[model samples]
Target chain A: MPNNRVVNKTKTVTDVMEEQTTVAPEATPAEEVIVDTAPAEMRYDTVDIDLTQSSETMLYSEVIDMGTSPDNYVGKIIKVHGQYMFFHDEMSENSYPTVVVLDATKCCATGLVFELEGDAGYPQEDQEFTVTGALDYPSSEDCPFPILKNAVITTE
Target chain B: MDKLAEYLQYPFVRYALIVGVLIALCSSLLGVPLVLKRFSFIGDGLSHVAFGAMCIATVLKLSNNMLLIMPVTIIGAVLILRTGTNTKIKGDAIIAMISVAALAFGYLIMNFSNTPNLAGDVCTTLFGSTSILTLSRADVWLCIIMSVLVLVIFVLFYHRIFAVTFDENFARATGMDTEKYNLLIAIITAVIIVLAMNLVGSLLISALIIFPAISAMRLFHNYFKVTVFSAIFAVICAFSGIIISILAGTPVGSTIVGVNVLAFAVCWSIGKLRGTAA
Candidate 1:
């Protein structure tokens, strides 16, 4: 018989299957999904630019070079070094951490705005930091500059 | 130094040095006339107007801020320079009012924005910043073109510029278009001030146009010598300042201005020794 039934072998009607959740229940524990937890090199996006080794001021210049052509940096893991500032301007609202380099006047600062990979506690602001992340652009209205997403930050 | 060589290898560092040098040369040359005419306040007033225009450009989310900053500053310079006794406000009064108003308005507009780096923006606009190190290829080209144009105009009309600076009435009597020259200088001044905002920022920009001119005046008596010397002097100050800032992490604008001040002192001392000091 075509329908020789085993313990949960009844095939649902094609019409009914289309309306249900596509993921079928797995009977075996081995069928559980595992998240990809690879190292940065093992991941699809490779570290293209590593600024961690650069001197503090050189890092600022390199960041500016990256800022000029943000589109070219997409999905590329860039490691930048700078003084970190916790971007919790409106404490009640969501915010990202920033690594900053002052402008020519030494008054204004421009840097990579970064969203962390997980809900990790941030360090004290204004410390030297080396942040690694994939380049991401925000909506023009939100920020005119490019930001780093899924970033991992380290501090000295 | 090894550190200097390391920094120089980067393209951005080279760009900063070029722009800094060009700006030094142009501003120093023009600064002689402006300082002699007691019109150095024009630099400050025009720079403030530039800051206001920059704020508007930011609020509008314009891709290139120069589009707005350039025209507005030019217009302000013309009004401040050309509108002689016709306006109720005197030239100095107009400059004072406009500079203060524009600075206040700029601050007001910026305060209303949701920019995350509000303090940084204001400080960068008001004080000098380190943005010189971060210029794009396009910005570098624009600076080069503007510097070349300014240099060519100055070279072609060197004699006339000297004549006009000394006596407007005499220049007019000699069938020279003094008003036109004044307008040209005003527009140029406006452009230079705006460009300088990228160097010393809006507040300290006057140093570029004022210091080298005054310093060179102390060292040289002839107009041609003063012009040449100021250009050379400004370039040295700017060049050394940039290197020092890069090596030691000092504020670029202030360091350049400080170097100019130091140069002025040295020049003044030499002038005193030569009995040129009045």
Candidate 2:
């Protein structure tokens, strides 16, 4: 009689286990774990300034050509070493950071404008610095050259 | 050193080395006969023709500029070589006329043809500012094929070339077709000139063709020894020049020519020392 009672208790326990397994999933409302799918800010810690290693005159020429055909360099992360200068527009009272690259002969020069994110301190006029950023063609009416967006500057 | 190793990994640098070495080899091979036959300036003339043709090609917006450049340069070579002796206009004079004319015409066309970055285009064309580094894969392959063809032709017809270079009239009297050999030389010269334009530009192509042979001649009298030495010297100079230019961020064509000039100077000094000792 004690053996029969033990068997009956065992059967009841198994039945309870099956009921829990079957109803547990349906009992919960199927909670959706929503994940944030927004893209992270594209930023680079270090950018290699290969222009210092490349042919200076040719690099200058290439940069000028890129200015003419902005479509070729859009979305490319570029690092170039050049003199840093700021142009203050009298009409708009806006100061723009420009990097001036001189050719090998130093007779010719080309300039590329850049935008910095944080307070990187104002670099001196004609200060040699390496700028790294993504190349962008701004839709601004006054800007004719391609720009470096979200730039990081380093002294050469 | 590490930077150079890294730079070499780039496809453009590899292409530059391949084309540069091949062009140097071909130019030096042809340089031997051209120097001996008093046709050293023909390289300059043909390169000028190539520059002019390139301008025309650019104006016409041709997909492949070599198509126009090759035929025009070949024709210029033929005219320069064929009419050299028969016409009142001497060879050097004709070459000068054509070279200057082509240069002037090319500049004029580029200036007025609405070509963007006119200065940059002219600078690259005239001085070869990284043109070797900017070559496409198709160009590199073409350069390789042409260089091999040039090498094979030089090796196969070495004896005939020597005879023609030494004495064309004697070669003709000896039942050899001197005109045919001259025509062959002209064609090869035109091709080399075209190929070399990327390495040293139109203004410096003559240096690429002349310096090695001249330096080799200073050290060796025999045609075979001179040709071999010229090829070696040209290759070394080209390699060193490219490396130095890359490291120093200097102009590639001028750097190669400067290396050639230095080699010539050293060879001249060595030749003088040997002459004095003897």
Q: Top model by TM-score, which number?
A: 1
Query: Model 2: residues >4 Å from true position, as ranges?
Result: A1-43, A48-77, A83-129, A134-149, A153-156, B276-278
How much lDDT does candidate 1 score?
0.76
User: DockQ (Cα-based) per candidate?
Assistant: 0.29, 0.13
* Local distance difference test values of all predictions, in order: 0.76, 0.77
**Pairs in steric clash, model 2:** none
Share of native C-alpha contacts between chains A and B (below 8 angstroms) recovered by candidate 1 = 0.53
Worst lDDT 10-window in candidate 2 chain A: A32-41
Candidate 1 lDDT over A44-123, as tens digits, reads 25577776655444556677777776665777788776776544335333334578765434445558877655432233
- Please provide, for model 1 over B30-97, each residue's C-alpha lDDT reduced to its tens digit, 9 standing for 90 to 100: 99999877898999999999999998888777899999999999999999987643687788999999
Error of 1 at A110 (Å): 4.1
When summed lDDT is taken over every stretch of 10 residues in candidate 2 chain B, the lowest stretch is B111-120
Q: What's the lDDT for residue A116 in model 2?
A: 56
TM-score of 1: 0.77
